[model samples]
Target: MQRSTPRLTRILACAAVPVMLVLAGCSSDSGSDAGKGSGSSSSASQDQQGGQKPATVAPAKYTKLPNPCKSVSTKTIEKLVPATKSKAGTSGKSSDITSRGSCSWNGLDDNGVKGSQYRWFDVSFLRYDSETSLGVSGQKRAENNYAKEISKAQATDGAKNVKTSPAKGVGEAGTAIRYELKKTGEDFSYATIVTRTDNVVITLTYNGTGYAGAKSPDSADLMESAVAAAKEAVASVGVANS
Candidate 1:
């Protein structure tokens, strides 16, 4: 009888195993339902947040820049630098001309009867492309760089009495940075104009000095020339792209 009683208890325990397993399954099902509800809410929240991403960016105004050497006109070149070594101007070395380009003209106008005048002009253009991933427009990029260029000119090495002012009618946005720099025992009047027209940023630097007792170039004259050249350079970008 004792042995039979022990076997009965063992049988009963085996029979209860299935009931315990059934109860566990039911608990799991309840948890799964709750999890599904929470997961759906989370997915909905994610979808709502995702709606704000992937901002639209406008197309760049100018995809390509003008020929650096040809950006300045022949007449302007003649007036700016009287005896330039190259009438076409010297093209600065640039690996990628599509986005950036520069040209420089240097000359020493030797007038034996009236001393000599040295003139230099450097002009550069930088084109910015809209970054869709970064959610930045090309115009905004150019605007940021325009400010940077002005700040950079104001911090030029050896510059003295640096002045900054608006360059009216030069471009959509423009700034003139003028300073005097002494080099090689000569005082050079420097005028730099930083301007932005849409996605393009134009920087024009014009400087001059006199030799053999001639008067140094006037700052006003240099600034005026810089503005004119900058306006032309800014226009060249549109013409090239158009």
Candidate 2:
């Protein structure tokens, strides 16, 4: 009976060793899994803390605009608007000269019995800035405004025989619009050119009216003068920036 008891004790001890080893192995596996979960959680938290970046906008081409009254040459103005009241050109009211500006000239060429010829000319400029939130470039904004100006000229009230066509060698892009209107018992001819260069938009308008018994000015002549003046104005933008 004594011998049997000793053998039983040894067997029992041997069984306990395997059971303890199994428990230790399970504990080690649990610790390793916990460490792996902690690492994954930290990485995910870091990713959440960093927000998405904003989109980058392109740089503007031109930063400044030319002086409105001096954008066109004096000789050009004189030829376009004969007998001008102000050779220096009358500047339009502008809150921000850098962003927007304008100049105008008007005159009356009286011809005794032949009636009178009235001429008017005006030019305006608008500059745009690059925006990040909108993700739009200044040149793109100018392009949009250029289209709007052409549409406005074409939609002139009481206009007859309206025509619009492209003008070459004027700027990056240009459009010439011509129309006739009867106002105050006289026929008035209008020619407008809208062009864009870089980040600036240039709009030039040349108009003439015949008073008394004078014949209305020819549309072709007015358009030619407008295109010439527009080319000068477009060139001025580059000069000013340079």
> For candidate 2, lDDT tens digit of each residue in 76-165?
988987889998999999998889999999999898899989999999999998887888888889888889989998999999999989
Question: What range of 10 consecutive residues in model 1 has the weakest lDDT sum?
Answer: 21-30
Residue 55 displacement (Å), model 1: 0.9
TM-score of each model, in listed order? 0.83, 0.80
Which residue pairs collide, candidate 1? none
The candidate that wins on lDDT is 1
Candidate 2's TM-score reads: 0.80
Clashing pairs in 2: none
lDDT of 2: 0.88
Q: Which candidate leads the pack in TM-score?
A: 1
Model 1, 116-168: lDDT tens per residue? 99999989999999999899999999999999989999999999999999999
Candidate 1 residue spans exceeding 4 A from truth:
1-35, 38-42, 45-50
Whole-model Cα lDDT of every candidate shown, in order: 0.90, 0.88
